[model samples]
Target: MNVYAQILIDEAKTRGITVKIIDEEANLYRLCYGNNSVLCRESLTEKTCAMAMTICDDKSLTHRILYKSGLRVPRQAIYINMTQAIDLMQTWNSLVIKPASGEQGRGITVDVREKEELQQAIKSASKYSEHILLEEFVHGRDLRIIVIDHKFVAAIERKPAFIIGDGASTIRQLVKKKNKALIQTTGGESQIPINTETERVIHHRNFSWEDVLPHEQELQVCKTANYHTGGTIIDVTDEVSYTLRTAAEKASHVLNIPVVGLDFLVPDFSGDDYVIIEANERPGLANHEPQPTAERFIDFLFPETKK
Candidate 1:
């Protein structure tokens, strides 16, 4: 079983649902619970939720339909050629480049505010995608609204996971130490990649990897808050508020997708203004742990069990 499938099995057990995993092949497995069975189906997975989730993953199609239905999403331009990227860059001063079918913020570059930077961002983002998503960068806190069975389950703020400084260790040392802790934290499913951007941030602050760390209370390195880039996920279930919930519900209904992950940028959820930057299908369940998205997914699949 893949890591995600394992998470589903683990969560199902936690929820008092008896499940059996049967191997159909070396890499394929089937999940059975009571009379209901889910096979190793790939639209990411073969289950009902996964199929619904698939509709949201192909961002180009999702946005096209959702936009017509009056759902809030960033103004997006899809390009398969570098010329088109350059053309779009000339018109938009600030934009973000992302894979049309990417997740976990992988291959996402934000704040390309200049021509050269935009080109480079486009090149990098396009490596993982044939069709690239070039969008106006929405400035606000990143909010993840997870919908299960057409209802909101929970929300999280993915603060870019980073290492804190202790005013003693070097930046390299700090990163190495944090990577070790992260492996322990996520069961070795992810790692932090050292990069020039991280080094440049360190150097810009008059420090090098070998120098003492930044002030304990200050943010010294990196700007992007992505889990794949070593960002943290904070539970903000209560903060999603009623207004945001209503908007998310409306957005989901408009899209006609049963399961979807909506990403928002807003100064405050209590306020009336916000931007729906993107909606994701196959949102990584591991990001929202203890809440058990997989369990919620199972419940969604087996709603008859509720009655």
Candidate 2:
């Protein structure tokens, strides 16, 4: 079962709600409280309309819709031609290329500073999507704000996967050790791929797999801050500023989505400046530990179970 489904199941159990796994492989489950019953597949549920999910599923459409509503979004476009991408890069100086519709940071390339790297990024993104997106690289903290029932529930700062040097272990060794720790903590669900993407990220940082990092130096190994891609999440719910909270809540309202995880790039949570990158209709409710995300979701789905 996906961790998200298990989280809801476990939370339901604590509330004396009946939980039945309808399809383990699909991570589908049913939750019951007296006469009320609700069904969910992972974090998705009936609260999300098909149209909202469809809009969120398409990144290009999401941007257009949100932008038209006057919400801040990174300058992006559905790919038309290689020349268009190059022109955008030249004007913006940095670019982000990724599959127009994907999750968990799949087929995403960040910090494309040159033309040759842009070519490779497009090729990588094309592997996953025929329609690639070229976005102006926005600089800021990567913040994920979770909105539930048109209200802000939690916020987190997701940092790219990194390792601190011990002065002895090579980058390869550090990565191996980090992956093992990630598996242990996440129950083998998350791992950093030891593939060409990893190699490219390190190479761009002027390091090799065999290079021994200086003692206590930090090196970010992955460009994508996604759990499945070895990134770590820090709960920042209490630290969220009013500006960030309102932006997230308003964005959710604009999309008419009751539950969503909106990804944004901001200089800081206290600032008004932020660019909405993507919205996940079925965001992982369990990611913000000790924040009662799963419990709130249950409350929203089965109001009678509320404490």
Candidate 3:
């Protein structure tokens, strides 16, 4: 089962809500508190409108909708052909190529600087989705802000996966050690994969898997700061600027979504500048520990269950 669903189920039980496993294999369940009952699949519940989910699931459409609403968004276009891809390449200088619709950064390629890189990125994205998105690669850390019941509940600043040098271990050894810890903690959902993208990131920094990094040095190994992509997150609910909170709320309002995790790329959380990247219908409530994410989600699902 996804750790996300497990967290919600545990929270529901703790709140005195009757938790029923409708489909354990699917991570589907029913939470009943008194006369009210809600069906949940992972952190996603019936409260999310299909239309809102549709818009968010499509990256190009999400960007268009938010951009039309006068919200800051990265320059984006569909990858129709090599011609279009190269035109965007020359225009943006740095680009992020990914499937038009997907999650967990499965087919995302970032920091495409030139023609050859762009070609490979398009191929990578094409494997997942026929309609690929070519987005301007905004330089910033990922900031995930959760808005539930039309109110900001939690914010997390995510840094791409990295391994700190311990002097003796090679990059591969460090990665194995990291993966071991992640599997033990994250139910195997957040371990870093040894893939070409990982290789590209390491090589970009002039580092190799065989290289023994010096002690105390931190090396970023992934371009995407998605938790599923092995990124680490720190709760920043108190640190998120009021401006950002408002922007996130405004986005959910524009989408008319009751619950969402809005992804923002920002140079800094304390600053005002940022580009809204994507909206996740099912944000990982478990990741926001001690912040009442699961509690608030349950409250929204069955307000009568509030205690």
Write the residue-wise lDDT of candidate 3 on 1-307 in tens digits.
Answer: 6788988898788888898899998899998887888898988888788899899888899999999999999999888888988888888889999999899989999999878778888888888988999999899878999999989999998888999999999998998899899888987889887888898899999999999989999999999998888899999899889889999999999987888899999988888999999988878888888799888888888787787
Q: Write the per-residue lDDT of candidate 2 for residues 1-307, one digit (tens) a residue.
A: 8788888899889889998889999998888888888888988887789899889998999999899998899898788888988999999899999998888898898989888888888998999888999999998999999999899999989989999999999999999999999999998878887877788899988999999999999998988888888898999888788888998898898888999999999897777889999999989988888898998898888887788
RMSD per model, one decimal: 3.6, 1.4, 1.4
Better of 1 and 2 by lDDT: 2
The stretch of ten residues in a row with the least summed lDDT in candidate 3 is 298-307
Off by over 4 Å in 3: none
- Give Cα-based local distance difference scores for all models: 0.69, 0.89, 0.89
| Pairs with backbone N, CA or C atoms under 3 Å apart (clashes), candidate 2 | none
Per-model TM-score, in order, reads: 0.81, 0.96, 0.96
- TM-score winner, 1 or 2: 2
Q: Write the per-residue lDDT of candidate 1 for residues 163-247, one digit (tens) a residue.
A: 6788888778888888898888776655566765466446656877787665674544555666666777888877777878888
